[model samples]
Target chain A: MTGHIYIIGMGPGYKEMMTDEAYQAMKNADVIVGYTVYIDLVKEHFPDKEFFTTPMRQEVERCKACYDFAKDGKIVAFICSGDAGVYGMAAPMYELLPEYESQNITADDITVIPGVTAAISGAAQLGAPINHDFCVISLSDLLTPWETIERRLIAAIQGDFAIAIYNPSSKKRHDYLEKACQIMLDAGTDKNRACGYVENIGREGTKTVVCTLEELKNAQVNMFTTVFVGNSKSEIIQGKLVTKRGYEI
Target chain B: MTGHIYIIGMGPGYKEMMTDEAYQAMKNADVIVGYTVYIDLVKEHFPDKEFFTTPMRQEVERCKACYDFAKDGKIVAFICSGDAGVYGMAAPMYELLPEYESQNITADDITVIPGVTAAISGAAQLGAPINHDFCVISLSDLLTPWETIERRLIAAIQGDFAIAIYNPSSKKRHDYLEKACQIMLDAGTDKNRACGYVENIGREGTKTVVCTLEELKNAQVNMFTTVFVGNSKSEIIQGKLVTKRGYEI
Candidate 1:
């Protein structure tokens, strides 16, 4: 017999934003494991379940904890913010599955419940900035190289796809957004191209801004901000950003 | 008094896939309106609510009807599959709001609740093919020009980012997916690159296929399919596709 693991995306730290599938998984799980921040998001709702958490930068250990709990025949819920598959813990968990199996402990059943990721949820606040083709790039360089992020930014701008920027700025990467905007501008993008960002999406102190590329370049932002550089067709209508489906409109 | 309008993304046509907010909006609305196919997906669950529908290619008429119902001070729910803001009725409805106000009937309150979109939802079925950066391009040239879509595909490939394609093929555009693969191949994409497609996502007769770019070029896909071409780091691990966050992994 094997234990079951549920890698669930909790969706922007709000219960209302989570899918019934994800909620049911949480209810079915006997144990929940996550980063402390994500676990605290759901601790109130599932007070009866055994909870385990790690602070940030402890992803490897977090995955190991979930496997250990699952190996003990507990229905383990490995939770993460946003869609579990997108920069969440699902891939890493799946990557480590073989390691656990080599110890004669198996978690043969793993279910991934998708949730509203930041790019899609943040776009809800700014109207429809991703109505057409769009790309999502992270400004954080912790896992990815800065050069790769820069090239992706240039490609997104050159492709004329509306770009959603995750982790736009952190304490160490305060100037990354400016560098990205410069790459876009260097690509001959119009300085007044429509742009916007949503800070702390679906959380307390949520804020939104709609401006041109020039304004976004100088805008104050933090790691929680989901920024967007709109396409050539993006516009500010009624103070909201919208990228229409067709130019004929 | 202006009535409220709730534009909700029903999320992959599954009750379990819908968000609590979308379900709540469905329960609170006096009536629900949508495309005929999408309405049928939720008709049984909320059989007591009044429902209105329009056939395909009648988006303008449908948006007008939602405004008309809202003007009558009814809690109108405008529902669509997947995230409402992404190629759904929200923008068009918002775009038409001013016109409805010209008739001296306004909907001053409209809440846009985001749900899981197909790209992210479909990714769950195929594992984590979007772990890092990704772009979504629809091959349907009905709304956007074909040349523009081709450029986006090339850019996504050149950027070395995973690409999720929406509306990959329709009755009139059955060859579009093939054309997209050819564009990638022409732009120096390896023929054996990891790629996948999910058919009828989160619905009956759901199917997932993981294969090389060469296989995808000739794969039989319909309108219901969501396709993807992986980045350089993408791989098939235990028959699951995953584009890892970092190459070192």
Candidate 2:
């Protein structure tokens, strides 16, 4: 019988923000597995527990190690930042686990504890950009086709939805944010919308900028940045950004 | 001179999950104000401080009170669950403050700290339903026109963006989710997309369900629930919900 595999979200950086349940869950684990960055994040909590750290893009092997250890009745945990389910390691591990189970390995007990993500953290930095309805899309086409991303951008603008843009740009793929804003402009008026960019959320050197859609075209953005574009109701008042709920004041 | 008001997001109901800086900032405040529920959430930490609580709908007044108190050069902190900038109390307060300041009652200083929101918490509970690019929308049209909400839904689906739906329905508006689902179906194949509904994300009595877009329409849902609709690459695998990042396995 496999002991449980607990995939926990450490949440954006700081441990104090971690839930008691998540902290206790991680503390009770026999072996903890995660990316080196995440392992470094919670290493102080479990100085004596076995630690397994993998390089970036090697989540498959890291998860297999966790599942294999858990199969032998070890309490194993795979950790990720800001909710394991949001562009983190949990789903990929879950997807690959079933294939390993056919090799006479049992895979059953698995629980995912939620954590905060960058978009919310970024939204918290900016004032209520997501107060109403919103959408989040990654501008990176590393795994997703650009064409598909373009379609989503066009649709989001047409819907007049507040949008959280993730993986906006990288060294390999520059101009994704510019293109996204261009698409939004094509769908609607550039002056009527509000946009915000939050970079290095929850970490030192974090910076946030609130501007218009046209301003986003020239904003310095990167993978660490999460961008928000407001709907028709979003506004900038006295340098404070707001997306009105359209309620009677 | 008016002391500043720091509106902080405590993240999803966990002290350990609260950012170190946000925790320190709150600890240094002279006065803290929030809804009774949020005050209760962080009660143990500020047992000796001056704290005030209000009913849910009284956010505007509560914020005003905080601002008034802060004008005495006292550091006042307003606490919000998840990120203060989301559907929390920050925006309404920001909107109301400038008007008060114009009357020569100088507005208190305001600084917003980001915290994790329910969408990430919901995603964490459901196992990576928001891994790819996604969008978040609130179904409540209390402040927004239903027509605007409808347009956003259609755009999100057309973009094939995974969407997080907040405030799905309330007492008076029970048909919002149904109508939103109908709009999604109209834009994409109901059978092709995956959706997850998570309720009471950080609190007890949390429930999560993963199903096809068609099944989501029939799922027992409510205003407390946060719904995630997967993009084209999203799928329900062996009861575990996932959205592919398109990276090589």
Candidate 1, CAPRI quality class derived from DockQ:
medium
Once fitted onto the true fold, the runs of candidate 2 whose alpha carbons sit more than 4 angstroms away are A1-3, A16-27, A40-49, A102-108, B11-30, B40-49, B100-108
lDDT of 1 at A183: 86
**Residue A237 accuracy (lDDT) in model 1:** 76
What DockQ do the predictions score, one after another? 0.63, 0.52
Q: What lDDT does model 2 reach?
A: 0.77
Please provide, for model 2 over B186-207, each residue's C-alpha lDDT reduced to its tens digit, 9 standing for 90 to 100.
8765665878888887777988
- The per-candidate count of clashes, in order, stands at 0, 19
Docking quality band of candidate 2, CAPRI definitions: medium
Evaluated against the true structure, the overall lDDT of model 1 is 0.87
Residue-wise C-alpha lDDT for candidate 2, range A1-249, written one tens digit per residue:
557888887767767656555677889998888999888978988889999898977777887887788768888888887777777777777687677676544324777776667767777667677776677777877677889888888877777767778888899878888888888888765754788888887777889888988898889898789898887778876665677665445
lDDT over C-alpha atoms for residue B213 of model 2 = 81
